[model samples]
Target: MLLVIGPGAVGTVLAGYLSAAGRSVRLLCPESALPALSAADEIVIDRVTGGPPLRAPKPLLTTTVNPERVTQIFICVKQPDLESVCDLIPPALPPSVPLVSMLNAPSAVHRLRERFPQHTALPASVLFNAQLLEPFRARVTTVPRIQLPFEHRQVVESFAGTGIRPVRAFGEASAWGKLLLNLSNAIAAVTHSTFRDILSNPLLRASYADLLDEAIRVLRAARIPFRAPLPVSLSAYQMMMRHAGALPWWLARWKWRLAEGAYPSMVSDIAHGRPTEADALNGEIVRVAARAGVDAPLNAKMVTLVEQVGAQRPPRYLSPAELRSALGHHLQT
Candidate 1:
């Protein structure tokens, strides 16, 4: 059985997909989330295949159950909620039941591994960008793709056909690769733009490239092997920025059309007055850079901007130029 904790966009996406795949998936959420979810039977994914909308019936299990019955538990909560969520997992869960965390940062894996020493703790990174449109409806801007670098092959295999395929990362190298990609979330969020937006803008694109470079440096300093995929790679991304003017007009327009529906998680946090994973996303970069004796001014500035915006007395939008100015020192250099 799959127990998906925190019925937010990520959790809902997994629940909807797995349930549609005929898996015994159960959604465990707080009382507050029930009202928004109780009345809906479908999750709308606008990013994957236009807007036909994906539906998952009331397969949601609201009541708490014995943890032992939960063979696999997917912790889909935000980074800040990790400790609190971990506390909620009953100790009675069988020692063999593996706990998979779909958190973005590298720190979450180490922390969860320490907290759930009795159970098999695996760190799984999700690649899709999901947004909750309403209580029960969510739009998946990206396909549901995930890579888990845990040592347990069997545990990863169990989720093979459930729309969340786990990729094996023999050691810490794979985890680092996931972390490198996650750095883009903050850039996309701070700009109040989609991934395509950030990638399209020459300045924003350069900012992203520099951020990844900083991340790569930090990983190398820590002796962690970090590799990025094509398009997202440091060199390839820089080339894209340099040749920004050469893209076909039609291709650029199509990219924007696709990104128009994409909603960033940090932007959602700001809109809803909820604390975001700034600490995990950008703050993680700062922490690691400091440890490695390197300065990650771009990420550090983004962390500050996100926190300040999130805490403002009267919420206001931080313009792209203003945000770019904030990171001027790093960018100008």
Candidate 2:
């Protein structure tokens, strides 16, 4: 049996996928989600790319883990909740249960490994966007795929004939590659802009470019192998950024294909008054930059902005220009 912890966007969508593929799955959610989870007989997945809604038979939901039946565990909580999730694992499951980290933080894999030194914690990346529109309903904007490090071929075979795609990564390189695209999530959270709007605005794109460039510099200085998350190469992405007008067209029509209606996870987190994964996203860059003796001013500023917004009861959405000016003001300080 597969135990998927957390009923948020990532957990719910993945539970749907596995259950639809005929796997025996269970969802372990917080007490807050019990009412919604109990009410829904099935999980509704609204595909944004023009497909009939997918209704998967909802799996059993509980607040506690049954270590006896759970053969494998997937930690799908937001970054802020990760440490708590880590603490929940050791006593609940046997040390050998294969654990997969699906959170967006590039450093999450390492953190999980450190936390559970005895377990086989595999690093994986989710290259899709899922939003929890309701307690039991989710909107998935991208076709879901899991990228696993090459060392986990046995785990890869577990998904055989399940329609779930798993790509073998080149070590930690895949996580860093995915981080390039995730840098924009903080932007969306702060600006309340859809993916299209963020890409379309010249100033916003410039800010995003700075964030990406800063991450690349930190990665280079740290001697970490990095790849472009988009279909194009890093060089091609740099070339595209040089021409602002071309950037949005590429993002909307080719690269991202993210629907205008899609909201990033952090955006939804702030909207729901849940803690945002600012540390996992921009804060990771700031940490790496600090260790490398490099200044990631844009990411640093974003980290501050996201933390401040996350603390609000009703998070105020900053305008794109406002976010841009804030970052600019910090750079000048």
Candidate 3:
């Protein structure tokens, strides 16, 4: 049995996939989302990655956690919700049930390990793009994959033949690598663009290239083991970044089939006036650079921009040019 906390996109993605794979799953969500969730008879697993949407019939949905029957737990909420959700976990959770954190940042699982010293806490980097279309619907825009801390067959095999595979190539390294790639998450939120737009637009592409260049330089200076975040290598992405503003004729595109609802988590957060993980995603890069006696002003800039935008009642908006200008002389090559 699996108890997935937070019925957001990622959480719903996990439930839908696991439930399809014949695993018993329960979703724990906030009370506010319950009404809309209850309206839907089943969780909708919509795919933009070349497939028809599938329905995963009712798994138990609750506002509270029932740990007694839960044989496994997946923490799918963002960093801000971590503490409150941690309090909901049964104090006597058996050591066998791993508290697997599928949060965006690698630091989340580190905090989980600190919170429950005796319990087994693991970080699993979510290597997929999913957007929450509704309270009970999640759209996967990419083929979903997970990077487990190690080859935990019990967890890996559960998703087998279910479209979500646990590829154990780089593990922790891939988690950090994913963080570096996610520096663009804030760009989507601040610019009011779809996650696809960030990479599709030449200006947005160049802006993110500037940010990624800054992060990579610092990570190398700190001697962190940089590896592939997605299935492709980091070097491959960096090469793409090099041709950031190139047209279709100048380069080969991945040709991602994105849905209209395909937006980043931060984009969704700002739209709904909820808090985002900008601090965790971009802020993590800033902290790492600071500890290494370097300044990650670009990443620091994103953290502040996301905060400023999200703090607005209507959510502050910026165009790609305005956003790039806001980054000021830092992005001027």
TM-score of each: 0.87, 0.92, 0.91
lDDT for predicted candidate 1 compared with the true structure:
0.70
RMSD (Å) of each candidate, 1 decimal: 3.1, 2.2, 2.5
Q: Number of the top candidate by lDDT?
A: 3
Task: Give lDDT per model, in order.
Answer: 0.70, 0.79, 0.79
Q: How many pairs of residues collide in each model? A: 0, 0, 0
Clashing pairs in 3: none
Off by over 4 Å in 3: 244-261, 331-333
Q: For residues 48-130, write the lDDT of model 1, one tens digit per residue.
A: 64656676665566647467568888888898888888887887888888788888776777887898788877777776678
Task: Report clash pairs, candidate 2.
Answer: none
Per-residue error at 176 for model 1, in Å? Answer: 2.4
**How does model 3 fare in lDDT?**
0.79
In candidate 2, which residue ranges exceed 4 Å CA deviation? 244-252, 330-333
**lDDT value, residue 182 of candidate 3:** 82
